[model samples]
Target: MQPTSELVFAQLKSKNSNTRCFDCDTKESDWCSVSHGIFLCLKCAGKHRGFGVHISFVKSVTMDTWQFKHLQMMKAGGNEELHEFFDFYELGNYAPEDKYRTKAAYYYREMIKTVSEGRVLDREKPSIDEGKIIVEEQKRVMPQKVIEKAAEKDPQNIKALIGDAFEYTKDLGRNIKEKVSDVSIADVENKAKEAFSKIESKVDSWNFKEKFNSVKTKTEGVYNKIAAKAKKAMKKITEEQDFDDSKLVEGEDELMLDPQGKNGKK
Candidate 1:
């Protein structure tokens, strides 16, 4: 059964759509050579048009009108199918120069002949289990462990590890030197000397002798006043001590002195 236009367009715009030009593999292909059922970039499409309509009928995906037959042809055959059919033995290996217009034209001509003969028009599809077996065989041929061991045994890998370690050590040493240089012994000594000089200057500015003399004079004055008071109190106590209770004059009570001699009153 023929596929719908929607299904055909959906396949074309998919992420896994044929993004590379079939002839050169240049990315962002916007054109498709409808007859050959292959995608092509603008540059490659122009070259295909030069080959003439009978050889390569080119159409733009965005601008061209797609008929039901055109869409059916695209659905039936795509870049992968065409490539597999043309390069069945995988012998048509094109070099860089072969990817240009002239060489691509030759392949397109050969493709036309194959299409006319209808060799790849309705080939049988491979079963899912067959595809799985093919994948498993590829894995068996080149195991992941083998590749890993090969990389580990490489001399370049060892040299790279050693180089990285050396760079790390060099960077660490540079950082340590930078930290050490930030603090200098001479700078510390200069700061200490400046602080000591400030303290000595402050001490020199004070009038210590004048202050001491002033304090001593005040202290002597206070001591004299205290001595005078004590002497007066003692004299009164001795004079009173000679008198008995009968010797006390009338209206006079016995004199009493505080033990501290701070106060003397009758």
Candidate 2:
């Protein structure tokens, strides 16, 4: 019996394979290039489409209707398999200027050529034993700190770390506020002054007088530039208002002096 689309998707998700785009490693890839057998993000998929059907036949995993045969083929030819085949010995070292995009395109072209010429290897389905070995190897090589962090549910996920940091800062602020709820404004000011005094004394004792003066001079320069801009803006506005007021006063005086004016004649 042919494999269903649901079955194929489940298999891919279980392996955590193709969760990221093959080109840029962007997460939550929604598109797949059938010819190259690699998952891609929307932007990368558009690039693949530009290569035409002969090069890469792109499809949306969610939006497009899938054929059983196509699904079976995808299940057999996953992203990891395609990557291993195309990036053998990791020959495509991406330069800073190429930014992986060029390398990705090259791999796609190579993969398409391999598929069309029947040079593609037969990929065996990953077994439970292989999965266990991969996990064991990762645990063996990973640092103690990294493993502990992962155990705390803070793996090397950048987005998650950023979110955690934001939340931590917010909680810290809230805790500080609660702790200082009963403290008077004067007390807080005194505490701040004491802290600055200690910092200044330490800086002086450290013989960092030259560095401190340099920093102070730079800060003063920035302040002066900002003050100058503000003064210029205020002067422009005052001059404009004065000009308008003078014109109004001149018009009033002319009307008062003119005998032909109705109010003046009265």
Candidate 3:
């Protein structure tokens, strides 16, 4: 039997996490991406709309009516699960390299197909107190007296520390690029390394090399797989052009590159 609109609304309300926008972290979600089974704020929903229906099938949570199929898609995915997938795949990092989202389409297809097949796509995170997560975030950026106090007592949070450190560099790069027309790669890299080094000096337990090596391994594995698929997609309609090699006698001292077909007859 098909579910009614009221039941879908009830399901949406039952999950407390559904109240938060998955993308912007807004307090209230007025829209949803039915394709991904994640809630969105009005602002984020508009952004998703720009991504095209192939990326996100968005609709209003309160205003738009829902069908049974939509509910099934919603059940297959949720905010946190998709968040894990996004973080694991490092989709944000791909945005710069993938302006056309040609490779990104493969990831979306794989994730959705896996989810619809009822298979897990990401590693499950161990349960942590919600307050601690909030405090860890605040401690990185807010610089409040209370947050600093909390951080002094809390065990080292490596993920948050490194993630924020990278985030700072990303923001710095964007700001610098906007102001300066031409910025060299070395300058940005040096500045980012300097910033990250300062943060790493403070964290005693974070083995950045080990973590980076693991990331490098995972990234290469995924990249090689996708590259194989992409290699097969190229379409060639033209036959090979055979160039004349008669212009060169055996053991020619110099090869002429002039357009004139008459050799030495200019």
Identify the candidate with maximal lDDT.
Answer: 3
Clashes of each: 0, 0, 0
In the range 1-266, model 3's lDDT, one tens digit per residue, is 77776677678668888879987678977677776788888656655554544556667666566766677677677778766655554554444124214333335444665676677667333232221121111222322442343345443664465455545544553343221223333454455456556665665543444443333333233223323322232122112211111112321111121112233221
Candidate 2 lDDT at 56 equals 59
Ranking by TM-score: 3, 2, 1
1-266: candidate 2 lDDT, tens digit per residue? 76677677777866566788877778867777776666887667755544434445667776667876456546556767766643542424543123223434444445454554557735433332332121111111222343343334423442233233233322322222222323333443344334334334544222243433333333233223323333443344432111111112222211111112232211
List runs of model 2 lying over 4 Å from the truth. 89-91, 94-266
lDDT of each: 0.43, 0.44, 0.48
Cα lDDT for residue 121, candidate 3: 66
* Error of model 2, residue 111, in angstroms: 8.3
Candidate 1 local lDDT, 105-188, one digit each (tens):
344444454554555534333332332221111111212343344335443343333233233322332222222223233443
Model 3: how far is 216 from its true place, Å? 51
TM-score of each: 0.34, 0.36, 0.39
- lDDT, candidate 2, at 234: 39
Candidate 3 residue spans exceeding 4 A from truth: 92-110, 113-266
Q: How big is the positional error of residue 39 in model 3, measured in Å on the Cα after superposition?
A: 0.3
Give the TM-score (vs. native) of candidate 1. Answer: 0.34
- Please give the RMSD to the true structure for each candidate, in Å: 49.0, 27.0, 21.9
